[model samples]
Target chain A: MNRQHIWAVLLRNLYLVRRSQYRAFSLFYWATVELFLWGFVTLWLQDISTPDVKITLVATVIGALVFWDLFFRVQQSLTLAFLEDVWSRNMLNVFASPLRPRELVAGYILLSLLFGFISFVFVLVLAFFLYALHIWSLGYYILPFVVNLLFFGWALGFVILGFTIRYGPSVEILAWSLPVLVQPLSAVFYPVSILPPLLQKAAFFIPTMHLFEGMRAVVLEGRFDVGHVVWASLLNVAYFALAIVFFYWMLSLARRRGLLSRLVMD
Target chain B: MQESRLPGSVGIPPILKVTDLAKSYKHLTVVDRISFQVEEGEVVGLLGPNGAGKTTTIHMLLSLVKPSGGSIQIFGQELAKDREGILARMNFAAGYAALPYNLSVYENLNIFSLLYGIPDRRAKIEQLLQEFQLTRFRKQRTGALSSGEQTRVGLAKAFLNDPKLLLLDEPTASLDPSIARDLRALVRNKMRAVQGAILWTSHNMQEIERVCDRIIILKQGRIVAQGTLEQLRRQFEQDDLEEIFVALMALPEPAMEQTERPR
Candidate 1:
């Protein structure tokens, strides 16, 4: 992929982010609101906890909140970035340049990292100052778990982008809802034990299941489940590979079908 | 960026060369067995009615559409193998495709310049901003611009690289007369200065006649006739290129005309 091309994509997208108040507001607002909603609830749960409850009540809620937003931040990073191109009708312009298909992906991947990190900083600071909660309080080793969730978000993002490109805007509703559809299976909030046994079986294929399960272990039981971490990492790589391959396929399909011109929004 | 040139050390090859170019969907052909060439500094007009496969032909040349059967060689390099190299020296604009709505005109041009790896991006952008009279509107969102202003911006973006081959699809549709005249002059002057070849598509017969050195008229996915304005006028016994175009559209080809949707 061309670095200059990648930089061009990034530069334009960031310009959109900087210029549009609505876009910038949407990026920062959701995480802050999610933090507040869960932050107060965690405080309420801490008040009513009994001795057998055993878990650090606030940490579980706060960790789940922070990491869920990380997953969400990257998801929006990838999905919204693709939508920016679609909505602006800018895909044809970019494709006409020397930028390759993979360069588009590379550029958005960089934006995902950039936005994901910024969201992380904002949410982390809010959680710390408001609830006196720290992700560090869980342990520095949770970094891998965070990375796994972010990759999973990126994977889901590619799937959404693929569907949008191949099917056109008629099915772009899939882009917004697909990630949330996986959330129930992901077990982002409650334990995997809370899931029905059949869903438990399906959850094994979902890497975030392993992550939330592993996060509970670290935060509540004071143990790092290397097995879950390893499983999540391997699945992250596998899913990410498949999604990217599928995305490239969809792009060529869009071109061959003469559908790129009509791949616009209403 | 410095242009990535073909191996034209001794003599310049045709700027664009297409051999047996055709496109089809299943059994339905959209563009059929059309061949053409454009030389250095020549502006060729691609004139055709709606559904005549003019857009499809342009898309194939840009590698945006897959032709059912054909070969395209731009600057003596095969398009399939040298797409990046060829596209780097080429740029296109259509009234249909859009710039980012949220980006300012300056940001949009800057992004494209960086993508093309232009050697002096700032100077290039500043020059275009002045030429398009977009300097004052540099900070305005592109979507907020008036239609005529947007057309100007589109043209400005297209000319950013001073490409050797430029493809314009209804490029001046929304421009005022003065702006349109200036843009036509720009295309005219670029060819003299850089030997740039433009494959321009416009419904305005007057505009095409003014700018194009040679004309290729298509009807129902096939090139019905092609020549200089004088040559075509002489052949069709018509007084003007517009009349020649009207006469060509009157030909019988209902089978090719309506069987498939314009791609």
Candidate 2:
């Protein structure tokens, strides 16, 4: 691959994300809604907790919400990409170019990350003002948060995008349903510890539990949850690897069955 | 000027060459052992019916779909090995594909221009906008453009990098007759000054006759006939290109055109 060419593809896609009204509004809404909800919770719930506990709890909620949005954003991007292309028959046009499937996947993932970052930062800033809480761990946790969120989203994105490519019209409902199942089990609103023993074991397998737990540790306790963060990151990487395999498998299967052409067929 | 001369000054080689190309899906063969050459400054039209595998052949050539077996040399290099190098000097335009609809026309062109890494993109984009009459709609979202206008934008984008190879699929598909004529004129004028070859696919026999220097008729992914417009006309003994197309498409082939539907 020409590095510059790939960069150009990456940059152009980022610009598209930046230019889209829906994308911009999504980030704004995500941030604003998060601040509104959690900020309201912080004010009303303040008398029940100490200052440090309040900041930590608020940070944890906002952070979880960011990842929650992150999950949905990836699914939306993947499904919508297929839907848009199908609408205009532009997918066929893209497949007609020399652009590799991997490059296209990478571009979509990168765009999703940018959107994720925008939402994360938006909520972070708004929550800071509304809750009057110091997000002290913002300096250290943001990068990891972004990285973990992208790996999870992109990994899931591959599976969703792959399914859409193969069984687009029929399996589209799964696109919406996926986040609902994954996010609730991610232990965003509550600790995994609170779950029943069997469910707690399952939650440990979920990458999101580690992510939320890690954020809580850093922002709430003023210390890194090295074990959980590292484990989550590694698990995420593994998930991403599996997602890639799934995507490639789907592509090959589609090609073999002549369904790959459906990718470009409107 | 004398010092500027270099040894073996052949300039750029032919932009595209295909040798013994063949592709099949499962037991069904789509493109069967076809071969062709495209030099700079040539417009070659690939014509066929719905299921003749015209699109499949183009897909193979562009490396969008991998060929079961064949060799494609683009810009004096094997396309399989040097995709980016070859693609850097190439562009494609078609109605079925477009810039992201959510993006404005300017942003869309900018994204493509950035992909091509064309120097001085602002100036290039301004010129293209003016040339394609898209300047007035630069900020308009692509989804909002009329079919004819969108076709113009697509055509404009194809020429953005001054590519050595331009592949067009129904370049004037939905445009009104007058606008189609204008696009043909634009393409004709642009080709005159550049060392570029255009591989165009279209169902419009009249447009093919008007714009293409050569024609290749594919029946079930195989080239049934290929030559200049006059040659095709004389071979079929038809008065017009459309009649020749009708006659060729009417015949039975390995893959029936009736079974394959057009989008």
Candidate 3:
């Protein structure tokens, strides 16, 4: 389709999220709870450590929260996306349209990233007043973080999308839980090296580990870890490419088997 | 392909043409060796029982499902290769299918307008809202609308860009009789006015006879009879279309029992 069509599709999705207050309310509640839960930990640590150590600890925590929200919440976002179509049975209309499978996927991931950006901005603004913790050079680092987050989230979101498309709605619970389960494995709450050797090696395979590391290094220490950023970016690209291939292949198979129209039946 | 001498046979290509189309699941053929061509400005009914592969055939036409064996050309272009081109000129609607409910009726229609890349979307949407009698519910959520209203919205969304090929599945499934009649008339008028073709699926034989120029009766994934209502009636030794439909859906064992009774 043309550029105007793509923009209309994109804007329409955003408007839906805005009108329903579903995504916005989700972000608000999630951010508020995280702020209080993490805020307590920051306070507890400050009582035990010197001012410099406390500052470092808080910065890492904030960086970790950003990565956590992006990686772990991605599946939730995808579930929201797929569920809307399934619950309303509107998927048939979309599948009937001329929009390419790739275009629909791109539109969805872009929406997810857009929502992620909103959450990031909302938390940042609320954190300023709630915690008084200043994130140094945030303006410079935000764009890169978002770019990385988009790739990473879409890569993770695709696996869930594939499952939903193939196995149907029963797997949605697993889809939501996957993100939360991957949090610790992704090194969002701690360093990858701190895990068991086997787990640490396994963590290296996840795209988010490198992202959280790069984010923590840059935002917390004012040190941009170029090697980590490059590695993370490459890993995300590879994962996203693999997801695209997987989805298209499944779609072709589904079409050949005439299972695509049976999407609602299953 | 042989070109038939129908009216408006000038430059307009057939809306849909399929050759040796086939689809099977687990070695069981659902749509086997089906071949049909729908000309522009024609409405064809796909009539069959529950598992007779009507939906499967439509899916193949829409490219929602790929053919196991043959070719599908929409507007004279292969669907697999010219998907976007073919799809942009087509639209589909069904009662069981709903638009994105989280979106308002207006936003839902607007999104589809955008998806189809219709120019002057606002004016077009307004015209559709008034035409579909959905003007008052423009800003209301789609989920809140009754099933009949939702189907109307679906229809409005489908025809928003005046698709050249429209695939409708039970277009009047859950609507009241009055609304159903209205929709049927609207579809007929639109098809006549706009050089479009419709592939409609329904069990309503009266509606079929009233609206369809041709009908394809499918049984067990194969075409049992296909022609205009008059042609099918004479060929089947039936006075009406309903008898032919019953004979197609009828079981063989009961006839054996009745014959064996020898009353």
Candidate 4:
């Protein structure tokens, strides 16, 4: 729990990203491109849509892309944090030092937050200056949605981390694919009503649905639904709690089995 | 921290104590109940064949793998309870395990220095860079360096914190004979300065003979023999350490079943 140790992990990772342009650029390349592609398409759609629905059409499309990117980033920041050491075969070295497992988690948590903020700013700027869709126009209500999305991402991050630490980099594909699996279920780019009935039923367990639904409520209906926000926030807490519990449980199992360093050799 | 052991058995405590350390994967036991100690200011060589459990032993000591049985203590503190405190004063460098390849020699060392909370960080890094003869390559990416040079950097990082106990697995494996000898000398210098011990594993019997204070030879998954070079030679009636090793390996399973725990 030493702050110095936590900062050490953070600083070391920052140094890793700083030394490699590919590493640094990859952080924003996909986020920026997604925004540009989607932003332009949404902006063009404003003309085809009826005048009454044009604003709603533009807001939801662009907002959905931005928010989805945020959720996607939660996975990247954490998996990268863990994988960076694995790629270098540096896990044995780091874990051998006095650095605690929790410190590693804390450090990556901070890294994810920084990355999330950076991507948020990058998408907002790209969305605004390149296309006229302003995220700020969604107003103060987006704040709660942002927070909820972050925890959902964190929850997913922890689950992937648990699997990775126990099984090795073999499960890395899960880190990327899990979020996309949630795409149709959470209805990222579409409303839950558009989902098949079975998926809509399953979407109840996904907190992202409420957050997205709540976002559309703010933009399309000009209605601030406390029920949706409260539901999303509560589900976020529960999912994240399960994630943390899974993390510690897997951590101890890894320790007991001596899978910690060997798991990351690849 | 036992007063009785401190006063009579040895003045300085054993840097590392692995008691009945064993690890198994359900049906196969990788490390069978092996026990050993490394005293302060000593270098103990851990030698075994390919599947002799050398890596597994190192992994268990670092808590990278959990043991099915036994305990590990460093600096008179159990690793289970004091992993962080024990590890802070310990470092590991292996010829096979690499530093961050993309990181410069200096940056890699800097990361370690901070993690260990080493005081006077800049000076310590500069000292290690110059000492390891890596000053010229301080800014070079670790991956870009020659294997010999990378080994030097790995050792340099391990020494950055002035650790009390260092685990070096085939640290001289990748280097040429001369560079390996120089690296061995560097390790000796650190051992003297820090009053530290090292658990070293290597295949080079000559190098082990020259660099180590004692040796533990493992076979299958257990320690078959251990002692200083001279003592081991006397025990086996062999003139050379490698000959002793050859003879020990040739031992029948039933004979080696009775492991000689060399103090």
- Interface RMSD, every prediction, one decimal place: 1.4, 3.2, 1.6, 1.5
At residue B100, candidate 3 shows an lDDT of 76
Sorting all predicted structures by TM-score, with the top scorer first, yields 4, 1, 3, 2
Could you tell me which 10 consecutive residues in candidate 4 chain A have the lowest summed lDDT? A257-266
Best by TM-score: 4
True contacts kept of 2: 0.35
Q: Candidate 2, overall lDDT?
A: 0.72
Worst 10 residues of 1 chain B by lDDT: B1-10
Q: What is the TM-score of chain B alone in each candidate?
A: 0.90, 0.89, 0.90, 0.94
lDDT of 3 by residue, A1-266 (tens): 36665565578667766887766688667866887899889889889998777767766786567556755455466557766676667777788887777677767766676677677777777777877767655546655666777777777778777767776677777666777676777787577789999998888877778777776777657777777777778888898899878877777777766655556665
Q: What's the distance in Å from true for residue B17, model 2?
A: 2.4
* Model 1, span B22-114: residue lDDT tens: 989877888898889888877888998888899889988888877789899999999989888889999998888889878899899999998
What is candidate 4's DockQ?
A: 0.69
Off by over 4 Å in 1: A51-55, B1-11, B254-263
TM-score of each: 0.93, 0.82, 0.90, 0.95
lDDT of 4 by residue, B126-178 (tens): 99889999999999899999999999999988987888889999998878999
Scored by lDDT, model 1 comes in at 0.83
Highest lDDT: give the candidate number. 4
Report the lDDT of model 1 for residue A237.
98
Considering lDDT, where higher is better, how would the candidates rank from best to worst?
Answer: 4, 1, 3, 2
- Residue pairs clashing in model 4 are A258-B65, A258-B66
**Candidate that would win on DockQ:** 4
